[model samples]
Target: MSDAQELAALLAQLPDAELAGVVGAATEGRAGLAALHAVARSLADTLGHAPDVIDVTPDTLPVAGYSQSETVGGSGQVGAGPVAPGIPVPPAGIPTAPSIGGYSSAGVPTFESVRDKVEQRYGTSQGMGELDRQTPVGRSVEEQWEARAEAARERLDQIRKSMQGNDSE
Candidate 1:
């Protein structure tokens, strides 16, 4: 007998009070399990009357002329009809994106090619040669720092003159 049937037989021999006591004791630490057991018992009682045999065949087969694939195993021989069951072919007239990666209708766009396309469609960035032609020669870092220091000194002189006038007042 199955473990469930054996358990049921053992439980049946217990007195009503003893069974109640056993259930009460189990409920303390195994409340979730007890609740699950109760639900399973209720479902078993409801569904025990009859078990139905279900039909599990497909409603319709693929049309006779429909061949799943043009080539089978690279043998160049076309399949006569629908091969082993698979996803149905999408209806025609639905627009689909082009395949990506190696050996497809459209070649995969490379970074350089994509960049060139974008530059051509949009405009190219300022080339170093063009920048050199347009801009004056750049000062060295030390010369740039000296220019900033001179500007700061002139600003400080102006501030000092303004403060002197305020102090006199």
Candidate 2:
């Protein structure tokens, strides 16, 4: 068989998740940085700039000597250390937040009206994918299990009380 076909056969043996992991690793490695640098250099050349003015945020890049697994599993340690404050500044032309539309004579614009206006401008009514401020975070598995057990105990206590009352009568 041809080399390309042989490589494809080998790759096909891997499951989708494993293949995706391989791809993610490749894109987050030196190869990825080199690719990004190339793109930035190309953009600079095209724009007639001697040096690229594009600045990638430090948080976006992987820290030195940290593996992908270590980075992914470090969520618990996230707010444990002192955090440096960073207020993001929007670009000159772009607004910091989407304009939810103006208050008409009827006061606040209706959802339909705001959606219509947003759809007209962006071709879709999907605003910034921010979570609703009022939506509470879900309970952990242990919390949920404890709650269920509590409810079950209360139900059993009620049944026992009713049985005792019937026996006395």
Candidate 3:
């Protein structure tokens, strides 16, 4: 047996606290072994291997360049569609889909009127995607409204100052 195995055997025969140091060393050794394995894997991958590719199932064989695994059938038929997971199929007669002729000539919200609540709630935003906006109107409406609001605030401030001066007189 190896020295590690012999030491481990001897340690196993000891009482709990008497073997603690050896157990702790063994645990630290496992961490070092893991780090060594990671370094070796990184070096192997740098030399043109893929660690993710190594984690493939037998029935699912590699097709285009050996990274992706496509399911294989008995009669030589390959997987024909996308492999996207977590996509829930809509129930019968639901008709959950994007609409054709979805837009009107005026660009007003129309068709199914299936308002995306997240888009509508956020409206115009710096962090959101273009499609995540409530409507095409969101940008222009917010801009015009803000400009008008600033002008109105300035007029209100001027009126307030004038009223205060008149009261002082």
Candidate 4:
């Protein structure tokens, strides 16, 4: 028998749970292989030649640290200072601004101020005014519940009459 036929025969002997586990593992393996293949194809397309072998080691791997490329002073060299850990280095060409709880010296509106301005300009929040108008004015929760209950009772009476007529026929 061929390898596929032999594998299928072996799989048939396995319990339902074991077979499902094998199938799941095989699916995950296939997906991982497919992803690796796609990455290789993308690299080949981008670069003139694709690498035959990628030798990844601890030394070759990127370490997380603040990049010294951003010079503190007008001097073209980076200053020797201890950077706070876990702080990320911003990418090149992007303007960096200091912010305090969304408030900035760059004339950017803070979160609270923005919300207030929007409320003032639009006359309450987007749909709050419409919601208020739609709501029954001066009606208590108990009154609304009683009104809904009366409507339900009327509907139930109609259904009962229809059912009684059907039974008589």
Instruction: Tell me how many clashing residue pairs each candidate has.
Output: 0, 0, 0, 0
User: In model 3, what are the clashing residue pairs, if there are any?
Assistant: none
lDDT for 33 in candidate 4 is 67
Cα lDDT for residue 139, candidate 4: 45
- Cα lDDT of model 4 by residue, 1-169, tens digit: 6645765777799655444444443344356566655554454545444444332222322356844444244443466443323334433433346664355655466888788778787886646766755667624555788899999999999999999999999
Model 3 score (lDDT): 0.52
Candidate 3 C-alpha lDDT tens digits along 1-169: 7645765666578654434333333234356566655554555555554333221123433356643346444555566545433233433432323442454434345635546645666675544656534566877777888999999999999999999999999
State the lDDT of candidate 1 residue by residue for 93-116, as single tens digits. 323344433223344565666776
Over the stretch 1-169, how does candidate 2's per-residue lDDT look in tens digits? 7645765676688655444443333334356476765554554455455332223224434458854444322255644444442343433432223333454433456777887787786743233222322235323554777899999999999999999999999
Candidate 4's C-alpha runs over 4 A off are: 1-98, 101-137, 140-145
Name the runs in model 3 displaced over 4 angstroms.
1-136
Candidate 1: lDDT of 88?
Answer: 33
Which residues of candidate 1, in runs, are more than 4 Å off? 31-169
Ranking by lDDT: 4, 1, 3, 2
TM-score against truth, every candidate: 0.20, 0.19, 0.22, 0.20
lDDT of 1 at 146: 88
Judge candidate 3 at residue 140 and give its lDDT. Answer: 78
Best by TM-score: 3
Q: Among these predicted structures, which one has the highest lDDT?
A: 4
